[model samples]
Target: MSAQDIARMDTGEIVEYEPVTPMELEFMIRELGARLENAVPVLKELWAARYSAERALIEEKAKAVLRSDARTITEKRAEADLATMTFRRDFDAAKETLHAAEELQKALASRLMGLQNINKVLGHAYGASR
Candidate 1:
């Protein structure tokens, strides 16, 4: 599946990784790395949005304090602000996506290493026979 297809996988869906030949593994690694690099900007934007959410919450509290709003009202407003920070959901989703990409990258590396080690062992066995 393409990277975008992977991204679109539903939570209830389970997809197994099919083993690739060593040559294909190298290309997959490069593709995954590029996807990760491309995601940097999106990650940055998500973080910026999260920070802005924090700032907005802080400003609301500060304004309430300045206006001498009732303590109960201020607390309730904070709770509401937290509940409505929709960007938090987006940011968390983006974070999870990046994490998944990293994990796939690691898996690709591990697969490549295992194949290389197997090749080396076979080479040694053949050399010994010669």
Candidate 2:
């Protein structure tokens, strides 16, 4: 069964029984392909446009959190350094802070990677559909 036949076969009966013309088949394929191709950009645009408000709010929250974290990390690092300066007694505290920072860095990196994967999937869907 051709692409067009499947498409028109809603009730398991071929409606266009006049022998599927080449032009008809091609037209159906192209039309469906175009629709699929256009869907990706449309979806992306929708995602971007729809997320504007939520994204803005998230951004504001993220900025505030980031600022707070920056201050905290700085203070912790300084404290760690000072403690280390006095003696090696505070080595554990300093190491813990460094480890926390590393964990946070890893989380952010993973988030970025996830976004990249989403974009790649969108691209692939767009291409395949087209």
Among these predictions, the greatest TM-score belongs to 1
Off by over 4 Å in 1: 4-15, 69-130
lDDT of 1 by residue, 1-130 (tens): 4644323334412234443454544554455456556756865776666666666656665554555544687676666556546645655665666666555546545654664566567567769999
Cα distance off (Å), candidate 2, residue 105: 1.5
RMSD of 1: 5.5
- Candidate 2 residue lDDT tens string, 1-130: 4545423423322233222344543444454455445545644554454455445444554444554534576665554444334233333444444454444335434443544455566567769999
> How many angstroms is residue 91 displaced in model 1 relative to the true structure, after the best TM-score fit?
9.5
In terms of lDDT, the poorest run of 10 residues in model 1 is 5-14
Q: Where does model 2 exceed 4 Å of error?
A: 1-89
Residue pairs in collision within model 1? none
TM-score of 1: 0.50
